[model samples]
Target: MSPQARRDQLIALGLAMVGERPLEQVSIDAIAEEAGVSRALLFHYFDSKQDFHVAIARAQAEAMLECTAPEESLGDPLRILTASMSAFVDFVTDNRSAYMALIRGAASADPAMREVFDHTRSVMAGRVLDHAPALEIEPTPVVEMTVHGWIAFVEQTTISWLTDPLITRDELLAVISSALPALASAVGAVLPTAP
Candidate 1:
């Protein structure tokens, strides 16, 4: 295979492994073995294990963003927000270990890992900003701030919900889906009935 193909293959393998186990527990040796390449060959593409970790984290970040993109077909602002929020919850549910690993990096001392987490958060918040005008929500600094905080709130609530799952999935999703519009309302936007 070509170099780029080889790199993509390696990252794909890393993503698969991360879904099953935390990044720290995943070994470069095991990934090399899975790829049928020697450890040194793996290092040829990545400077170190940390570099490999960052690459896999970035790929997963991209996947999360892609999967959570609001459906343009929905058109209605509340519907779009509801669909995207459902996707976000489902994505995290589908990759619990991987999300935990990202959270670990987000809270760790390493700048690279935290960047990946923060970048994901920022992009997610930007998506809300993009859809704000449709809901008649003025995109002011206060609105932006609330949207960002809402993302963090959703993330934390999801994390906790996964651990205990005290409420039904529908109830949890209802609360999450309603959170942003309610927050925007506090910031002076009149949202239609939340989904």
Candidate 2:
């Protein structure tokens, strides 16, 4: 493989392993063997195992962002929010172990992993802020803080839902979809009806 292809191959191998186990437990030796390369060759692509895991975490972050992005083609803000939340829940459910690892890794002391985590949260929060006007959510400082808080709330709630999914998927979706709009209502903005 070319140099970039080799690097991407190693990262893909690591990301697959991440889906099965926690990030810290993703064995570099196992990945190298799976890639048909030496551990030293793997190291050529990454400074260390943590660095490789960081790359995996970055990929995971990007995947979540891509999957959870609102379908602006849906037009109505409420409908867009519902589609985004549904997509987010489905992505997490499909990648449960890996998503948990990403959450745990973000909570770790690793700065690089934390940066990836923070950026993901920022983009997710930004989406809500970007659609604030349509949602009738005032994009004030307090609204910005509320949006970030709601993102954090959804993350923790989804993690809990993964642990014990007593609630039906649609119920979970309803709660997440309606939450920010309710918060906007609390702040004097009228919540738009979902189409």
| Best lDDT among the predictions, by candidate number | 1
Question: Model 2's lDDT to the true fold?
Answer: 0.86
lDDT of 2 by residue, 1-195 (tens): 899999988888888887888878899999989998899998888999889988998888899999988898999989999999999999999888778877887688999889988889889989999999886556877788888889988989888998899899999999988988878777664434322
- Listed in order, each prediction's TM-score against the native is 0.93, 0.94
lDDT scores in order? 0.89, 0.86
Give the range where candidate 2 is weakest over 10 consecutive residues by summed lDDT.
Answer: 186-195
Residue 152 lDDT (model 2): 84
Model 1 C-alpha lDDT per residue in residues 54-162, reported as the tens digit of each score: 8888898899899999898998988998899899899999988888888788887889989999999999999999999988877887888889899989999999999
Model 2 ranges off by over 4 Å: 189-195
